[model samples]
Target: MKYDSLARDIIRHVGGKENVIDVVHCVTRLRFRLKDEGKADTERLKAMDGVVTVIQSGGQYQVVIGNQVAEVYDAVLEAGGFGNAVSQEEKPEQKGGLMSRLIDIVSGLFTPVLGVLAATGMIKGLTGMLAALGILSTASGTYQLLYIIGDSMFYFLPMYLGFTAAKKFKLNEFVGMTIGACLVYPSLTAIMAGEPLFKVMEGTILQSPVHLKFLGLPVLLMRYSSSVIPVIIAVYFAARLQNRIKKILPDVVKGFLTPCITLLIIVPATFLVIGPVATWMSQIVGAVTMAIYGLSPMAAGFLLGGTWQLLVMFGLHWGMAPVGLNNLVTYGYDAVTVLKSATPIVTACVVLAVALRTKDKKMKGICWPACISSLFGVSEPSIYGVTLPLKRPFIITLLCSALGGVIMGAFQTKAFMAGGMGIFSIPSYINPETGIDGSLYGYLLAIVISGGLGFILTWFFGLSPEKKEDSASSSASDIVINSPLRGRVIPLDQVEDEAFSCGVMGMGAAVIPSEGRVHAPVDGVVTALFPTLHAIGITSDEGVEILIHIGMDTVKLNGDGFKAHAAQGDRVRKGQLLVEFDMEKIKQAGYSLTTPVIISNTPAYQAVTVLAQTGDGAGTENGAKISCEDGLLCISTC
Candidate 1:
């Protein structure tokens, strides 16, 4: 509820509740499946308070809100009047290609459980660490209790996945869970462990031991506990079956009869056919992944590690998560998780180097917090705000990460369990039965070398100081955004609206207009002209984005006493008329005429300096009156 106002602002900027089809949250992001992404004001949302960044990827609009994403997500849902369940009618038509859809599906399925999954994984790793250090015996009750806390999630993973997948496939959740429970029932598991009555195709990989017969049909029994693919496949089929069966059945009995028939048919078929087929498929997936790693560990590591962050940026990393989990369940260890582990540390080091080296105070402030977040295994801030924007530092980070992956690969490092990221993940590398081992040492060495090189290389080669001539010369890249209105200047923070004053929407000065005419601040195309004629956005030829909002809450007037001089997408020169509004009318309507001129893409520049000027071009410190076309803010590219 504390974020209710922020949430309302976010929803309005994201094109309101009508634009949203579905929304969910992971550890640090609020991902929305929107009906039309173009309707969302991405730049405005990016600059909004409480948002770290905005990304449109994997067919979703993602708003990164750091660790507090869940609370914000709840706020968004409540503020938008979107209850817990999204109606089927609201589901948007699927967009994008196959890869995009796959990424969307995978993210939806796994995101719901990621927080608790990581928590339990950390507990498991801690128990392993204690046992490895001889601080606790595995036989002790304390260790046993801790192990169960950690291990139960994985042991009954199918059930948890069943519940989530059912939501995704629009099935009755209880039925999906019932299917999962049947797969791992004690009776079925007991029968699987009993002596085989017959063996089929004994010489081939398809060979199976028949533990029982159902209507003269041999049941190829296999352990379903901890398996990934079987339950999901079963649930998908169950959903399809129940839907069809319900349509023909009488309405009164449909609810009860549909579920009973669905369970009666799907559960047995899952045991006899779907379970075996899906288990084999999972094994093939794991085997193929391991075979690639086995062929040339170093090469595989270099490729995967280098592209990991890129995949993460686009949200394609979700597609890789199940593969690692499958490998852990099938082979008891995964190489994919090992190869990617060094990336966050590398990102942290790169951001740290940038923080120390940058002369820009604003850049330094952004980098320090981003570097710390990267250390905790969250790197979106570092990637989007610092390294990626700077260009060279991000490239250096990738090269360093690849080198680290090479080292890890050559040592055959393996992750025994899913755990926390960055330094917290070190315990997962500890060999359970052998205590301290080569894998742990390999992991430590990889991170150290990668992180070390990330800092050293970035500080020296990645970032260089601006040339003296470049700093002094009037280059084309340097833009001067003039005052859009003849007004008395004020600090942006003094503006009444928090969205404008908090500096989250990017830095610029506010003006209490002495005149009603608004002019183009730079030579650019009109990117946006709000229907109410109270706001305008221009993208300068030099790539500087400026937003001129006429007055506080003037939008509520709905175009009263406002006129647009130029339409959206019209090319205009600096000082050209854009809009004319009646200041007296806005004030009469109880609105503040403290208009904000913001550099919407402030992160792309080195610094945005506010200028205080007088009639004779003399500089003043406070409340200087300015004319339209006079220099307001000087943007430094260097």
Candidate 2:
């Protein structure tokens, strides 16, 4: 319900359900893979209610929806006839370069869990702060309990990564989790503790070999708790192996046998081959990262800090996930953690500047919540809703982050534990053994620099370079009612039902649906939902009342074929999915499939406008199809 209408409108405007190749939502945007971007009415979308901006970037037609994108995503799923929409990410077209495809996979895998990751990180940071302040102690039960709670997510990182990897690769999730479990099994740890029965060459990859063998080849056993790369590689192979197994297996045994054969082949392959190779590659990545930092910490820091947010915008941040995790696993701390920690705070400060500077009341309302959300380490709301829309504040925040990195690098900062971004993660910068070390002080100084710079620079120069106008004014002035069905529009007077045809109920167009669904024509609250489910009442925010009656005298069917997804008093949006029905059932029951979309208060309006059929064949029913993107009518007042 949160973004019910926005979701529906976005889906339709992006060329309806047919044009979408797939849809995914990041923190503040609905990212769509569309068959053709040209089909979308971009200007209309930009002017629509509830949309922040329509940005076409990174091979995604992204509709900015502020913080409630997940809800909108669910609504889009229902509207598009998809249930449980977040299973496998849409595979990008292979025609693209490898880099784009890689980015697609990485972004898709990481996007769903990022919120929880940040939340758990914040908890860990707070618990550390409590211990540092002496309110909690190492030996206390409360501290121990909270500590376990905070650390569980990181320790079990591989399992989460495994689930995402399997889904991304289109393999069974349980099988992927099983592979992840094997990597970190207590048995593997016990075996690794004894001695290497055999070893690889000393200095190269898999230098310290293990005694265990998988089908006779020596297995290189390594700790897999908090691992990121090994499980992903294992699942990728498992996905391919499972798909192959399905081809040869009979239908009766396919479900269980696919798992059996795939895991049998994959487990040993993972233990003997993929695990060691990927772990070794991850090690090299960590070493390369440190080597760069070793050259000049400040310069490396400046580069990463300044561009990290930019890279995040393009989903390039996932490339660094393994490197950071590897660093933490190898050295018990990481520079990348400290290098990027100040970003959210910098973003938060820039938003505060916009909130202070904007004359538009609607813009002010958007900025404050976004700024507060940024403090908790989610910056997309601030980025898309406030700063990015304004345009200038984004530049200020990046400059602040770069300066912040310089100060942090001078202290040779490192995070002793995993945590979220922002002031809440300050304790992560503190050394676990020493507590409140020079690096923690350095982090504090960096935050001060970042927040202070963002505030001052943005206060002076952050007004949008683009001409400013009240977007809400446009919303208030125009009420464009879109078609509520995929159907042929016919004048209301031609309908056989006298209640609708003779203007007894109201004046509006009637549609004989080509599809079995009903959608909202405007942004409104559901004033009524009939018990019979044959009709619905929606009162638009602009004070226009609409009654959508489905089929002629179809109430006799008594909700048999009609499935209602919305209810009375729920606010809805233009093109949002409202009800679905079996059109064939209605026709079989001797009822017409024609639906009337009536403005119930016709006398209150100055004029009502419906589109005349304007297609190649004159006066044909299917000649010009009316959809949500094309107007059903214009509600006008003199």
Candidate 3:
């Protein structure tokens, strides 16, 4: 419950628990699929504390929560009444085009294991570096143990993919895992390596040695270890197959019978058809990618590296992960993806430059942490929080990273294994057989020049004096909170309750209501409406949050004298009647009709000025009558 408040706020702002169709988390974000994206308050979420930023892309509402995203994700599940298992029935109707859905599906499948994947990759890379450096002998038992720990995930990647893919496709997870286990079964792998009975598809890319016979059909076995696409396709097929089997079988026998029938059909079908096709497709993709990279390595590097962060911003970065893994499996080492190894370092350098030059304390604070995180290969914070908000610096990062990519590509740098990110990934360049090679040196040199130049260029050219770009961009207009009640305007401090009077809730003017109607203060959605109808919260379309409390300690009356005209999540225009109360009835009930209208999220704004009072005088003093049409408060974002 450490993040309980943040969790509740997130759920509320994301159109409540009912709006969420499904939710998943990655390294640093909580990705939600909502039934209606329109109900979400994007600006309100962006202004929230503990959230790094909010992104809507690839058919997802992604809330970036820095490194604590996992804990926050757990809290969100608990708070939103969600079970750990994802249900296919819960998924919203698909929106967006093919690309968007692909990105969503791919990210979801990979996100669950990304953290541990990176960790294991790092461990393997480090051990490889140690072995190459002669710090540990490859024959050493300690080395063997460490390698096994690090390598097991990659070796049995098909099974992991099966488990995750089954969840994504809504199949029984264990059934998919069983299919994967069958693909990588030790005996099957050994058979694939043995002498073939005959060769089939003799003269084409599809040509393969027939390894074994499956009920008289020639089985074309594929090396499933460390592979990507085959298991995913197989699992999808198994999921569909299982669903079909369940429909035919009766409930009494279906529990065990469904899987038994599914496996019998899918396992052989996979080895005979799905495996060969997917493996060929993966090989074709790898071949095409390598050929493209081989044509002009630097150009490929420049394009991919420059746009890498942009892809990360939209969560499309996962698309390239499969390709990289395919290359690692098809070819022993990957030369293409290794070109982007310097991108994080480049981002780190750029943010460091921003931290050094920015006059704003907040930007400086954000930059320092972002810079540190980027150095460790988590650049989402730097990209979304620090640089992307300041357009010039973000552009500088891309250009620098592109140049770094060009340099690395020119040297033909390659990654022998799926390594760690940022600095820890350096060891992935070390040749397993040779000590330090030109590739590793070339990578080191590329990062140095690229990162150093990034700092220089960003410091000198990325910012302007006063760092006014952000302020200028946000200067479209000030948000005006109109008076929500016909009453005598009074200073908040003069109110009876200390919570509102002392500005403990937020800063805003109060009113002594002459009438009982409460109107919408701005064009916005009603975010919160208390059951007692004595209080309401509205976040304006432009992101100012306003709270109107009917009276001090009014909860005792419950819904006695209060009536709601608008419910929570209702979209209302300025001056629209939201709530009505009987003033005489409240007065007779002995409750003070002192209403405090406040900006609930005051800290996100630069200033909250009480506009001039009306009727009696134009100054912001007490005892001035104000109408619902009058401008009561002006909020400035920058």
Candidate 4:
């Protein structure tokens, strides 16, 4: 758990498990729907190691963890035990308009399976590439088998949509999958294509087919596989109907009858009405999309491409995802999302430009990975780690990408499949019947133009004034630390915190404080103080970064029982009052004040040891009193 401490820190700074309403993640960010954004320590989150940045957008508190967000998300769940939050209701006061809610819902539904979706999509693209290169014949068994593997996800997409929709709607996930399975059931599509079981009223439906009938009503049959909107709508109604059935049914029979009545009614209604209406609605959506794309493709391209990152920043990209997916299903190709190709390509180019221009050694190293990652269609690194922070570079990248989009639109570029983005998505742009068409050439041109423009724009004016490199060094010899509070000294290994006890956070010792007041143990400058006021960090004149934590997990108190007397960066003498706390308040709040005072930078020292002391330290004695002026620990420098 390299990120365990980071996860723990994230959880602590995001107002704890009690404050998190729900949490989910995408490629690079852990999007937490928090109970109170006001409780979050944004500066702490940004300054913490392993966290790239923090964003409060579209009613989500997003912690940018770069590519390792999934692992961190899992660790966060494990740390906070927020698994149940996945199916919980969104708070009414979470804020944002309908756009935010939609993004939240769409992201929740698609996020779980997007990894597999990308994998299969990439395989499909690879297969296409193989076929195009004549490495595998389209007629070969191997090609056919791999095609089956690649196409299965799209072929049975309804089931996947149903499962995700059910989870989002707070209904049984398996039940949703069952509904999805029924939608893609093999015989259903065959019957719809072959012939109707009986004929419906003439001209009622264009195809003139009714595959199945219930009682006397004609059950309209349509191909439901690969469809998104219908199954999602069906599951929505299923959840509502399931709830209603459960309410009316008796407890003993509720489990059996609720699903029985719900599915029996819902599935046919889906087939007879919901599916057909939703399918027609999809046609209307396709028509509207075609209209939009047709309304001066270059202008459409420029607007969408230029503003997409802004949408992404505000988390509004989710609103467009369904539109693009719908276009893919309805038209057998997508233009809306296909135009987004320039964004990542441009990001890679801009990062390369910055890498070349910047004198920042760390930044030069960061740009390499960010550039490569963006080329493969993951833009978080380039966006968060490089461009966005610089402000100007990000805007320039967007404009350059938008110019590429305009060219793409002018050529009428479109994609037939989804895949890993950027250059990897090229196979997706190839027209199936024609090998490579205008779409491929035009999109390639877009990438070239976008990259070229981004590089040129960024290299010229993207960077800020160079910073002086940090080159400070230090050396030291034997030095001792005194007790920070009136308490009984305890061995570091005996402390309750595993990080301190196991020497992960650093070499540390504990004190079961007898007095609530915390004092400076050495003549030092305060370096940091926790937002909760329960912890203080100091850098001694000898260059030791010492941490004085008031209590175990006292951060959860939200500063209720703690008060800071010494501000961060203030120089203080030994035994000077640094913090005052309510011991009874902490006790009443059910927190033990067995504080740990440790040298956080203990690794810098050759050895750090607690000094053996006589009795009467900080009023824990039988007869005498000793303040923080007393010695606690000793260190020998490397």
Candidate 5:
């Protein structure tokens, strides 16, 4: 919740606010556009509080903050500035780069739509399931009411596009919406319906043709409901037109004239050229997709199912949405059938693996909700919190997905509707004329085979080291405490904050007195000292890695006032110093000194514990000790 301070520290740590170009947010990450990627302090940011992880992907420096990303994004904006203007200018010019620009434009257009699209998709999926299970009947009032819940959004999709386009193009949103509304107006829809209003003979109207024109140019009437491209183009042009007009027009006249002129030009042009062109292009895309589906259903299935996860990883899956929607609109079904079957199977596999591999009660508790959410077609929890962290499970799940996709493709399975990937998507697979007996069997079989095989494989091989280690009876005498700091002992859990409340970060007695100094807690070798110097890892003679982390967000200082006493691979003794810092200077620089003494090699430990309070003084017999039982100085205490 208090990520403002952390964000400020991160910006300053990564070469200061001037180095940042722009900051934006996705569902769970703060994506930054930096002037120079090389100057980023990745390790330092990772060590900060409230940061779940950090990733550099798709030319973006992504700081993952989980559910609280909006808060972090606000904090980042306050610390840095708005817009990616700096980064944009710093970007190198490319030759004949239309393709790259197109890709960027398309990605930007769809980014904000992804969340709503996914939600609507899930809702549609659920409606199908309810109808299928007899809980709701197609002819019933209840079913009709619920159907509207999911269908209205898609039916008025042009409006959604207009809003998103306005945001993307930095235009007036209401104006965009008005333009979209005009295209979908009841009268326009009625005119576009059935057949041509009239056949022109020598450019003369017969039976009063419903032709719309601007300045003598005939406008081509095309349906805009559920359409994607035309409204976006209209809004983009409208924004530019409005801006240009506003610059020269008097303020009193500008307000009314801008909208009047924008709509007049945009609406006619949209119908005359933009609408027709976009429709033709969409048709081509749809045809191409159908052709691919017809060529090899299994191949298409395998590719879609196997690569869907990868697309999701890069946030590029929204590019395929038009295809799915086009299929639904054109043929009332989708031939790319593997996703619904493969996604659930892959999710089930990961959930099963995590359930069996982890022994940590807290972790297990978290995984359960993630697994349940996945069953409903939400994979974020599983992807970020479970599978990705475990490594092997994620790969295995993907492999299984590919296998399942191939089977579905071989069957030439098709979904007769557009919906989310889950059990609820079964209705989309339904052949209504033949009832539930059509493609339903094949889909069910695919799910069982892929999920069952994946689950069994992971159960046997996915066990984590932390689960197998003994924790209830390990002894501190067998373990060695490698000093993370060289300063004098200050006692246990001293500094401040909830991070040190239950020793969640680590376990050990706290230290103070010296000027932010770090020393070897035991005779061991330094295995890793992060580039940011926020934390260090030392492997003791007993083969346990002791991690010493300085104050929270201290990494944001970017090694400014701290100096490392040793380098990687250095051998040191219990009292050998590792790093020295100006504690007073660091505190004044705005960093919390609630240090954590963690066991980086948690797998090697049976248990670790914190003993005594801050004033209890170190080196005393009353201080903490690692043991098997739950006591103030025992292992079970953790």
Candidate 6:
């Protein structure tokens, strides 16, 4: 995917690789945090191929690349070099901001594991439902075996989070994992279950409290295991401490002595001070949540349920997960019942709406698989394919889910067991001791109402636009080209060693000359010329804006070794020389020469096709003809 090159080029285009403080990607876009947004060339990038769109939103410079984003991301990485070079670490000044740092830390820790995490969550949710329905008994062998499948990942969550946090903090992950392992150790858990090790006397551990006289203070007890905030905070300090210790300790005993001291200081501090404080803080947060839930269950449910998906969209949902886990550990049940109920109901509605609305045979066939996946709580397919495309369906789904959540909250429906949401989440809501008669009915009603409402609303309001037939008579007869360069007509893709595979960049072809001089392809005025002199934009007599980009990342060179033959707003004729470049100088300077010729006004064209390929008896040209393979890119039929 040549992500490194792509990343470098993108960074250079935005400003420079150095100007970027951080880089991350969601499903379809590369999100960059730039040092200075003023240096970016957003318009030039928008005109490039494989780019769906360019957006600057929410303090993010986003480049959308559709489905092949991973490929582009890889290319960007390859070009930018590996490790902290293009990372958030480069901007220490901004790290002081709490929300920014938190977002950075959470994104780094959770983004990589989100797919597996979501899958395991759904699996656990489903298992609970089966158990509640009596389809699988808790004592059954199958239930016991499946329990491990879903529970193992979460039971060891701190271990996974430790590794990710280590990476985010730029610390040794192995060292962090070692600390995490100690916290979750069976021995520590057993010890914490027993009495305090010693009584505090004058800031020291002693056999009796009679000696407590120094500053009139008593010592503290130390305990560990199943504690969250303390271990994370301890590791953060440990990482810094380890770095400092290595520099001061003598080489002979440094290795073992350093670790021993670290453990002695960190472990006690964690247990005696950090652990208790963090635990107390968590209790406070839980208390606040309880108060909210108690005040208006319906409002709490509606707020959390309706916004759960929105939180997921921004990747902030992980922030709430620890709260849920804390509830399960402390109170044995989370008040946030809407998380489980809302996801499945919304997903089911989206799938149903997609199935009902889509008319294209190919899309209809794809919808079946998408719908099945949604049932299993994999909603990306349904979201992107069905709901997002058919906008109103998504809105309807969100509304219905919120209504259902309100209903569930009003009933004070609580899951007796801790688990995930969805149809499979039914079991978690069941009170085994009381059978399924308690609040199980409310849970069932929520799901039915939400899913039913979403489907019915979408079915009535959503309509898929019909595909238009192509006009066979409208061909590539309008394009008349004068040579952009006087070199022999060689296959555009076959131009020596090129950047694009062949000359096909997106939906057009380019002319590769023996030299780097660029002549006008048709009579037009120069509309734009980049400061780098590597790209030029010209509007032809026929109103086609042809963009000619000389090489990849050439903009970084900043106009070196190239001269513009024409100024912006200057009219040019076919074969009129535009830009002259030193090909040998550029090559020796380590820059690519594979230029891209793109039709900037692509949306206005009915269709674009490449005609340079020969099957049996067609003569090849230097460039390919651009026309529609299926039909026009855009059209108005009479």
TM-score list, all predictions: 0.45, 0.50, 0.47, 0.47, 0.45, 0.46
Q: Candidate 2 residues 1-638, lDDT tens each?
A: 66677777887799999998877664345778899999998988888876767778556787766434556787888778754355111332222356444434544465566556545555665676666667888689998887787667666766877888887787887888888787777787688678678777678633656677766777766567765556777899899988888999999999799999988888887777755665465455445545667898887678677876765543335446766787789999887646767888898899888788655455576677667657766575566456654446877888888888888888888888775456667777878888888888888889888888899888887763322223463333445677888878888888875546766466788888999888887776666676557777777755677878888767557678988877654446678898999999999998998888888777888877776655445452343667666777777666
Predictions in order: lDDT: 0.75, 0.71, 0.75, 0.71, 0.60, 0.58
| Residue 389 shift from truth in candidate 3, angstroms | 18
Tell me model 2's lDDT, rounded to 2 decimals.
Answer: 0.71
lDDT of 3 by residue, 1-638 (tens): 79999999999999999999989764336879999999999999989988867778667788877546768987998899875544212232332467545434554465566555655655665666667667999899989998898778767767887898887787887988887788779898788678999988788655668888988998777667665556777788888888888788889998899888888988898888865665555445445545668798887778777877665433234446666888789987778878778998998999999898765555576677667657767665566556765667878999999999889888888888885668768878888888688789879998999999999998888765321223442345566788999888888899876546767567899988889999998777676676667778787766677888898656446668888887554557878898899888888888899998998778888888888775875555757889998888888877
lDDT of 4 by residue, 1-638 (tens): 66788889999999998998889764346878899999999999989988877777667887877536668887897788775344111211122456544434544465566556655655665676677666999899999998888779867877887888886776777778878888889987677677567654454322335676778777765566555556777799999988888788989998678778878988878777764454444444334444667787887788778866665543234445566788789998888766667898898999999898765455576677767667766565566556754557888988988898898999999898865456767888888888899999999999898889889888877764332222241123567777898867777677765545656556767788888999988776666665567777777766777888787656556678777776553557777898889999988877778877788777788888766566644332232333476767778775
Candidate 5: residue 531 lDDT (0-100): 53
Candidate 1 C-alpha lDDT tens digits along 58-151: 5778787753565788798789977554421123223346644543454446556655655565566567666766798889999999989977
* Candidate number with the higher lDDT (2 or 6): 2
Maximum-TM-score candidate: 2
Of 1 and 3, the candidate ranking higher by TM-score = 3
Write down the lDDT that model 3 would get: 0.75
How many pairs of residues collide in each model? 0, 1, 0, 2, 13, 20
Which residue pairs clash within candidate 4? 482-632, 486-618
Candidate 3: worst 10 consecutive residues by lDDT?
A: 86-95
Worst lDDT run of 10 residues, candidate 6, spans: 628-637
Error of 6 at 578 (Å): 25
In model 4, where do residues sit more than 4 Å from their true spots? Answer: 1-115, 157-170, 191-251, 265-281, 289-295, 300-405, 411-441, 451-587, 593-638
Q: For residues 1-638, what per-residue lDDT tens digits would candidate 5 score against the true structure?
A: 37778878878766687776677654345667788988988888888887766777656777766545556676776667653222111111221256445334443454455455445545555676677677887899977876677656656766766876776676667788888788778797666555664443334211123355557665556555555556767788888988898898898897688888888888777777764454444444334444666787766666667766655543234446667777678876665634436675567567766775654444475566656556656555465455644546667777778777777766666687665457656666788666675366667777778887778767776542331223454543444353454334444455453334334434555544345667676665665565556667666554655667677656556667777777554556667777777788788987766565665445345666544433324343334332212112223312
